[model samples]
Target: MLETHGLTANYGQFRALFGVDITVAAGECVAIIGANGAGKSTLMRSIAGVIRNAAAMVVHRGEPIGALSSAEIMKRGIAMVPEGRRLFASLTVEENLLIGGQARKAPGPWSLDAVYQLFPVLRERRKSPGTALSGGQQQMVAIGRALMSNPELLLCDEISLGLAPVVIRDIYAALPKIREGGAAIVVVEQDIGKALAVADRVYCMMEGRVTLVSKAAEVTRRQIHAAYFGEAA
Candidate 1:
């Protein structure tokens, strides 16, 4: 489980988040949704430890980890599939996946072969340069790379961004399996439908603050529109 309390972030002099608070229970899938610049990515980066915050801001299993380094965070059983799927262009798919396990090999159900099972095409393209793969395939590689760490908490930032609907569906389909494997997921996504469909709870953010938090299945479009855009749809 993870929690962020009064979490704030800044870009030089520009503040990006304002006292944001949220939580994810063990094995639950939580989604953060908002328009561009709504601080969704910022929130993810903060949680992933890419951007340092007050030591008490981000807590994992009741431990204060907001100020931990990204690598430290990874070693603590939290892995991030960053926005843009920053795969190594020079590394082969298998090599990229291997790099994930190199940091910390925490015991879990994810392995090279298990990841391949989650996304079968990855096994077929194991030796191909990561960038040589199609967008959807590349995304799969990104997810596979994170899973290779066998993290307890996985932070996915925009996994569906820029992919075709079918391709996005393929990627989203792996969420339940990942959950079944016992990892809690916090997905930062723009596709409202996909986010709500996969998440148990959804947080709608606007201008760097949380405007709505609801059970995903029960959320209405009008509420999301209002919370996301600050007005009625």
Candidate 2:
């Protein structure tokens, strides 16, 4: 449902992406894996409209949306759980989830109860300030907040960063439910194991380009290592 064609992006003159092409089909889970500075996050930002590109660069269902504002892209059914889980510090936990749905309220399956169901702790701490929560809780809030938008495509950037293995597992365990709710997911992750466990397809990037793309079961560890570091076996 989302695609990029010859997508190139730049911050002023320093180019970050080189003819990057990727695709995420409806209800499929795609994982993007790479090391730091490999342009994984850059690609996510470009697709989310945080970094503007030429009209022909990014496409949503065959329409050029590269130049659209982030809000515009969001309205077209794309939502992002950014790298930092940028929740409003002043808002309550429940309030954060509420705001995610503000942009497009013509909901399909996500609601406050559903979010709470996904992460039960969120319901118990619904009134607490978002920043007051633990890191795991905050991450849960971030994921729930994105789901509140009822988006067709969900972009998860570094969702496992700085979290414990069990916590990451818990977060990923919710993926089946999210997929059941009908959203395509693009997970940008550094933890290869977690990404491979949940992804139907995986793409490994290195130095601003995709070096490997394969079905999750089809890729070997050696290939992943090579793609991740741009190294030879």
Which pairs clash inside model 1? none
What do the candidate models score in CA lDDT, each in turn?
A: 0.94, 0.92
Per residue, candidate 2 scores C-alpha lDDT tens digits across 1-233 of 88899998888889899999999999999999998999999999999999998978898998999999999988888999999899899999999999998867666799999999999999999999999998989999999988998999999999989998889889999988999999999999988998999999999998899999999989999999888888884
The sequence of per-residue lDDT tens digits that candidate 1 reaches over residues 1-233 is 89999999999999999999999999999999999999999999999899999989999999999999999999998999999999999999999999998867778999999999999999999999999999999999999999999998999999998999999989999999999999999999988999999999999999999999999999999999899778865
Model 1's number of clashes is 0
Winner by lDDT: 1
lDDT of 2 at 56: 80
The runs of at least 3 residues in candidate 1 whose Cα sits more than 4 Å from the true structure, single-residue gaps closed, are: none
Measured with C-alpha atoms, the lDDT of residue 46 in candidate 1 is: 95
TM-score of candidate 1 versus the correct structure, residues matched by position: 0.98
